[model samples]
Structures are given as C-alpha cells and as structure tokens.
Target: MRTFFITALASILTFPVIAGTMDIRVLSDINLSSLIVSPISGQYAIMADGQPVSDSAKANIFQLILEGDSIVMKTLEKKIGKFAKVIFTGVGKNNIIKIKSVVPAGRIRSYDDHLEVSVYAAYMKVINKVDLERYIAGVVEGEAGGVTTNEYYKLQSILCRTYALSNVRRHELEGHQLCDLVHCQYYRGRTTDADIISSTAATKGMVIVDGSLNLITAAFHSNCGGQTVNCEDVWAIPLSYLRSIKDTFCIRQPHAKWKRNISTEDWMSYLALKHKYPVEDSLSFNNAVSFGQAGRAVYFKDKDIKIPLKTIRGDFQLKSTYFSIEQRTDSVLFRGRGYGHGVGLCQEGAMNMTKLGYSFKDILVYYYKGVHLVDLASLEFFREE
Candidate 1:
C-alpha cells in the first residue's frame, strides 16, 4: 500500500515496477460442492496437502468434491485419495486450465496460472492465483465488453489496475486478495480479447492518484446521461477527484436512457409506509407524481421531506437516480437517464472519446478531475526525498 506524489504540470508519470500476483476467489457467489478441472496449456503440478502427487499432463483432468470437512479428488477412471487441500501449481509459462462446476451445473471458464482448492465451511472453495496483468485484463473484459478501441481499453485497464491494487487486501481474512464479483471487480479468469491484453500491457503499472498521492476510487459506470455526479451526491463523501462534470460523448449511447412504470398504488404505498410521506395531502400527491429532474437532484421534490433519490432508485429497481416522474392512468412513469450510480468515469463516454481520436490519457483526465497518473515505484522515491 504505497502512494506517489507528482508535480502539478505533469498529467502522466511513471517509475519502475516489480511483477506480482493476486489470489482471487473464483465463482465466489456459487455454492459449489463439486467441480472438474482440466489443464488447457503448459504444465501444472498437482499437490495434495503440499506434497506432489502427479503432474497435470499425467492426470489430464481431475474432479474435486466436498465430503464432510475434507475435499475428495478423482480422475476419469479411478478415485484419488481424499485430502484436506488440493493445489495446482502452475509450472513454466503459458499455464492455463478449464474449470466447470458439477454440483449446480455452472458454465465452464478458463483461468491462467495456479489454483488452490479446499473445503470452506459447507462447500468447496476455489481460488485462482494469477499474474497481476492477467487479472486486470480479465477484469476489464468482464466490466466493459463491446467493440472498443485500444485507447478505451487502455483507459479501462489503468482504472481496473488502480481499483485492484487499492483494494488488494479486501478479502485477506478469507485467504484471497479479491473475489470474482462486482463487489471487488468483475473478473472471469483469463481474457481472450487480444486488444484488451495488449492495452493492459501498454498501460502496465499505471494508476490514478489524487494530489496528496493517494489512489483514487477509480469508479466507473455504463453511461452518464450527458453529465456525471459528484461523489458526495452519491456516497455522501467529498472526493476531490470525483467531481461532477458535463460529458457529451455518451449522449446517444445505449443505456443512457431508460423508462420504468410503477403503479400509483404501489408507489404511494411504498412512500407512505416506508418514508411516511404525506400521501393524503393533495399538494404532496401532485408533487410526487409530477417530480422532474432536469439535472441530478440529491433528494426528491420538497425541501422539508428529504427522500433520497438513491433510495427511490433502489426501491423501484430503477437504472439510475437521474430520472423524471410522470403520472399516467394508474401508474407513475419514470424516465431515467444513465445506467449506473453516475460517478467517476463513464465507460461509454470514454469509448466515444477514443473514437473521436482522444488518447487514453485525455479521457482519463476529462472524467477524473485534478488527478495524476503515477507508477507504483515512485512512492518509495517520493518518501525518501
């Protein structure tokens, strides 16, 4: 956990770096009892409780299942001995493996480097120990997938890397650095996208930092609906780098606008029961149905009654808090703008900027205010100085 300081004139900065790895909990949300692991490339040393048993080439494919508090291993035609832990140590370069869950019948996925399998609580827990760059590529592919330019991919790569390193110890108590979920970053193992891999390499060890040399939140979303909101408006914390700004790049992109309908009864009942709004009053009822958000508003209409737009968005399952309400026959029509929390970088806007010939640095600075791109190694130099 290091921070880098930079001069005000510089927008992009760099320093040396040491290659590292991250342990990510794979299929973290699934309650898996059994899974099949097969080697796809390179070699893997199969170890049962730290003792080498066989190589991946000899085993070809192996099945792991949970039995009581231990893990049972099996091959195609024979059953291997049960062990408390099973580890697949990736040897040499180009190590890759395919994993498919058998208990709940989940889809197959390919991963790079090593894997650690053990029994946790009532189910089997699998962790993918992958290189840092490889993990960032997988995260970028999962978070932003579409026809994208190299600059856009590079922008996303730096953001993903910064986000990853910032929260590296999020699940340290659980025996992993991060999880393959949106809670950390959406990572689905090794990515096959050539552009994504190249972009990640191009921006290796790059991260965004505030003026105080601390890593920014690096938050991003699908679209901003023409403008982004300040961090305090969303999370109630004033982040200097996460200021609101007008972004016209994603004005016409997909997910920028959405419409949802909620019955008047349901809406009134929720407001009346949960928020204790004066639903019976004629003025409040009219204001509730006719609420409009020409721009982002922290709370619903009326100064005294502070109904957070975020709460309304969550209760109604709306796409975003930037929405306008209208009364129809028996329902309230919510015309929503944007597709996420509307903070920090806008993925579609950055992609559009790349199409307009803007470099990755240009897009990064445009979204994140008063931030500098620095390398991890610079922290030590700045501290020593």
Candidate 2:
C-alpha cells in the first residue's frame, strides 16, 4: 500500500485538485468459467492483444472464456477466436459497461464505468475502473443497505472513501487497487438509489483521518449491541481513535442480540480438547460454564484456564465475543450481543443518530474519537490516477 502525508495548507483555494480513480476487481471471490460483457449505453471500444478490434458500436457484447493460461473473448451470438487480453473502454463519459456471469444463473451485475478483464490463476478477473465518488455510492448501497436518511448515507460514504483510499493497494499484486469482496469492501456496482448517490456526492472527497491527519481504519459493523469495543481488545492493535464507547442507539435495531444452543457434552468436550480445560473438576467447571458480561470480556475465565472470548466465538460460530454462557439441563446456551468484530462505528447506531437529526460529521465524531475530515483533493502528498 502507498502511504501519503498532508501538510496543513495555508488556504483551500491554493490546494491542487485531483480526480480520484479506482481499479477495483469485481467478483473477485468467485471463480467463473465465463462471463458476458456488453455496453449498456453510449459508445464502447474493444481492444485485444493491445490492438483495437471494434469501436463505437450501437450494440456490442462479448463472451470471455479461460483458455489454457490466457483469456479468450468471443461474441455471444457468434463464436469468435481467442484473445490474450481484452480491454473494454468507454468512448464517451456516458458509456456504461455490464458484465454478467454465464456459468451461474441469476448472476448479473452492471458497472457505470470501463472494464479490464484478464486471466489470472486460471480464472477471469474483471477490473472496474471508476470514479471515486461513484464507487463510493455503490459501496454505500452494498454495505449500508438502503439507509433511510441522507445523513447516514453520508456517514457511510465517508467511511467507504476512507477505507478505499487507505486500502488502495490491497490487490495491487493482483493487478487492481481493491477487490469487490468483504475482505476489501463489499462493492456491487453503481447504485440506483437516488438518495445514496446524492448523499455520496454531498460528501465528495471527504474522508476520516486521525488526529495526526493520517487516514483511520474506518472499521464498522452491522450493530454493536449497547456499546462498542476497543480495537486493541479485538485486533490486539491499539488505535488511539478506536475506543470503546456506550451506544444505546442500536439497542432496538435488528441484529442486536442473538442466541445459540449446543449440547452440554459437546461444549465441555470442545473446551477440554482445545484448552485442556478441567471440565471434570466440578468447582472449576461450574465457574467456567456460567458467566455474565455487563461489558465486553477479553476471555472466559477459569482459575487456571483463560480462553480468549474470540476463540470461543469462532469455535461455536457465535455472533460475537460479547456473549455469556448458560448451562442448561441438556444444552449450553450462548447468548451473544452485536454482530461482527465490534470495533469502531456501529452502523445501526449511526443510522439512528441520523434519524435523530445528526449530521455525518457528528455521527463520525461520536463513533471514531478524535478524527479529522479531510478533503482528498487538498492532500498535497496524495496521488491518484
């Protein structure tokens, strides 16, 4: 990943303006045998093996197949010869590209930008080269899921932008800046929701930065129960801005609490096998099996065994680490609060805040402590292509 620094500018007028572009790998997590590429609007030009094949056509669609160690582009209606590399460029700014998976049914996605499809590891990798703001709109729709208010969308947009900018080189070795997956960021494509698009445009080029003017992680989750967790507690990396805070706004929202039941025998056996827990000892077993958490606990404690709560959550496929274990007659009940890693911004809480007439900046400051909102265009050290 490339790192940049920004010195305080004397005036916003003197800052150099730069247009941000991102090369995001679409459907990166799925391995497809073939894909259908078409131009939805405006004019498109196709290039294969560094040479132009067609340009500015009324209707253009091509099928891409993986052949040996290279990608072959063929027309959908007629069988065309194979090609090494295929580049679909928009002739005008109004051009839109649509790519659909032919192998999987009901798998169709469109992009409001150009595309570069290439072969990698015997799979087709489609890279969507799009404007930063437009990409943020898609990400907001994908991650936030139709927030009711523009304020919430604005908050999501800023976080999405910050995360995208910070992790720009996440897939650089794979020939793209980022991947359209949860690992990088869940980005579907251009968002049709007018509110989300307007919200994203409203907060254009704005991103969250730490007190030192460096980009923050911009971590977020679906909900946080009634309180958020510290970054150090979850990831073991202590970030000054990511602190635990009480968040009651998300309590009434969905995904606030969850429960799971497991056989008592299985639960004990798992602890015994994984941590050598003394499940046979009645006293230690009793103490370890039943516990309550008013706040997040680092570990499920016993006299000698200190099992990290995260490990237990993962072992049981629980919702979160903030859970309490209850021993029933035949089963052990695990009651969990929140969803996801539970560090940084709580999406539900932020949404509620927006509903209560809070601005995006207010919601950001409430979740991430001591952060600055900086304009990407004004960053002297920032580079974009």
Candidate 3:
C-alpha cells in the first residue's frame, strides 16, 4: 500500500497543473451610461451584493445602468437596484457571456468565464475573471491575429504568457490584475481561430524567463528592417536577454520601408525650436541634417549637440530611428526602415522562420538571447494547493 501511494504521488508531480485563472479588467477606463450583457451559451446565475438574485435564471439578456452613483440591473423590464456589485457566473463549460455597451452602438464583446461589475459614479466598471489559458487564447489572437502559422502562434502564446505573468499585478490598485488595453495586453474577448486556440493550448502555461528565473518583457514589433535593437536603446533600461541582432527575414516585409518628405525650412525650424540647434551654422547643421545610416545610429549626429534618434523619431512621428537624410531641391527626404520600437522579437521575421519550419523554441532563441522556456504550471506559485 505504501509503494502504491508513493507511485501515485510521483505520477501526479510529473504532470503540470492545467487549471489556473486570472482577473482581467475589461473596458476599465471607459465610462458608459449602460451596458447589455447576455449569456451566449450554458446556464448562468446573476448575483447582487453576494446574494443570489436568481438561481437558474431563465432570462437570456440583462442590462446594467448607472443611476446617480448606483447600479441598476434590469431584465424583462424588472429592475433591481442599489447593489454594490453584481456577478454573472457560468454554471457549465459551454456558458459564455456577451457584453455590449448600450450607449455606444455596436460595441459588443464576449467572455468565456465570469464577469464582475460595479458602479462608480456614472459608469460601470467590469472585470472578467477567467481561466488563464482561456485568457491567453484571446491575447494570442489580439496580438498576432489569425493569419500566421501554428508555430508562430505558439511563439506568440509564450510571449503573451510571459508578459501576463510578469505584469499580473499592474492594475492591483484599480481592482483587477490587468486591463483589456494596449496599456496592458490587448485582449478582445475570445478567439474563434482554431490554430490560435490549438497553439495556445499546446503551449499552455509556458513562459520565457531569464537565467535568474525572472520573466522577460517579451516585447515584439511588426518589423525590424534588417536588424533588431537593444532594449536599452529604446527604453533606456538595459536588459541582457534583449540584445540587438541582425534580421534579414523581415527586410522585404510590408512595414520594412517607409519615407516621409519634410520641407527643409520646416525641418530646420523644428530642430531650432525643439533642440535649440544652430540651424544658421552651416557646418554643424549640415552635418546633422545630411547624415546617412549605414547602421542604426544612437544619435542623429556625432557632434556634441547629441540629439537622440529616439527623440527625433518621436518628434517627427517617424516609423523608426534607422533612417537616412537626403537633401532634395526644396524638401529633405527621410528614408526609414522598420516599424515600431525595435526592442525584441520581430513578428514578420518570426512568421518567416515558422514558414521555414523552425520550431517555436528556435524562433524564440533567435530573437531573445539566453532565455529559457519555463512552464508556469511547474513553477511553485502556479501549482495547485
């Protein structure tokens, strides 16, 4: 009997825990007068202030309205009011809730698990408490979309998981752990793509961590032209794993090349106004304006008046800092490459590598240097009690 018990324990420890949930605040920063919530699938119960208002509720739809700092819930024209909070919980596996804002026409979204709503002043604050794996599926679609290959989806799944685990406590003060915004991770409810769903499930609870067991930022961009940039160059915080690398895969991608023409006078005026650059001094000004980028330059010029390329990118609303300046007749042509902050993984490059039959782990290693793919379920904190 003792040998049997020991064997069972060993078997259980070998497998990872598959059940973990997360509290994601959706539409957190939006203020709406009323919202419509309906159960798309399965049975759901509506609770008011911790008390069950109706068990096995028959009504398929409900509306929540804000009335003078109080929340009022109405279903079938029957109104219930003065509740501090309301919870909509699914009774079975197929139960899914559809939430839409009544004030904003056609603003509808769906969730797979449960929803917690409360009234603050004249608006409704909603939080979606859902299984972590399910949330990751939505995040994968939200970040990468449905067009990429399964391996690319797997790579994105790991990145999304790592990002979620790393910044899980970002919105603790606001109530939930994370919000459904780019400020957090763009989570647009559930995903319908089979590949996204399968990939997310395949890489369940997998996250990228550095040598010290800390979760890396897992930053990604649309394209990197011909190279990826270090984190320090973009955000000023140097991370060892986020090293710059040459990437030829994304060179011909859609976001690889860009051009913007600015009048030479307007360009000089911006430099003069913003950086107090000596535009009148032909020697220094000419050196700064007529520069070419053989590679990514930290500064627009090598002179002492060092203007950060990032600042220039921000000021001019440029695609990237990797650009060269060409003096035309009346306008200064700015030829740029890449899109977004080239900090970590390049999505186009990753997609190409996946097309070339590279595994998700191989793609990750190519982008993020010295990172380990660790399973969240195997971690102590993620294990079931």
Please rank every candidate by lDDT, starting with the best: 1, 3, 2
lDDT of 3 by residue, 196-294 (tens): 999899998788877655678899999988889989998889999999999998998889999999999999898889888888888966775688878
Superposition error at 375 for model 3 (Å) = 0.9
Each prediction's Cα lDDT score?
A: 0.86, 0.81, 0.83
Q: Write the per-residue lDDT of candidate 1 for residues 295-335, one digit (tens) a residue.
A: 67889955488998999888878888999999999999999
Ranking the candidates on TM-score from highest down gives 1, 3, 2
User: What lDDT, from 0 to 1, does candidate 2 have?
Assistant: 0.81
Per-residue error at 306 for model 2, in Å?
Answer: 1.0
Candidate achieving the largest lDDT: 1
- Select the stronger candidate by TM-score from 1 and 2: 1
Clash pairs of candidate 3? none
RMSD of each: 3.7, 4.1, 5.1
List runs of model 3 lying over 4 Å from the truth. Answer: 1-19, 381-385
TM-score for each predicted model, relative to the true structure? 0.92, 0.91, 0.92
Worst 10 residues of 2 by lDDT: 7-16
Choose 2 or 3, whichever is better by lDDT: 3
Pairs that collide in candidate 2 are none
Model 3 earns a TM-score of: 0.92
Model 2 alpha-carbon drift over 4 Å, by segment? 1-18, 55-59, 76-80, 104-106, 381-385
Q: 333-353, model 2: which lDDT tens digit per residue?
A: 888889988899998888889
- RMSD (CA, Å), candidate 1 to true, equals 3.7
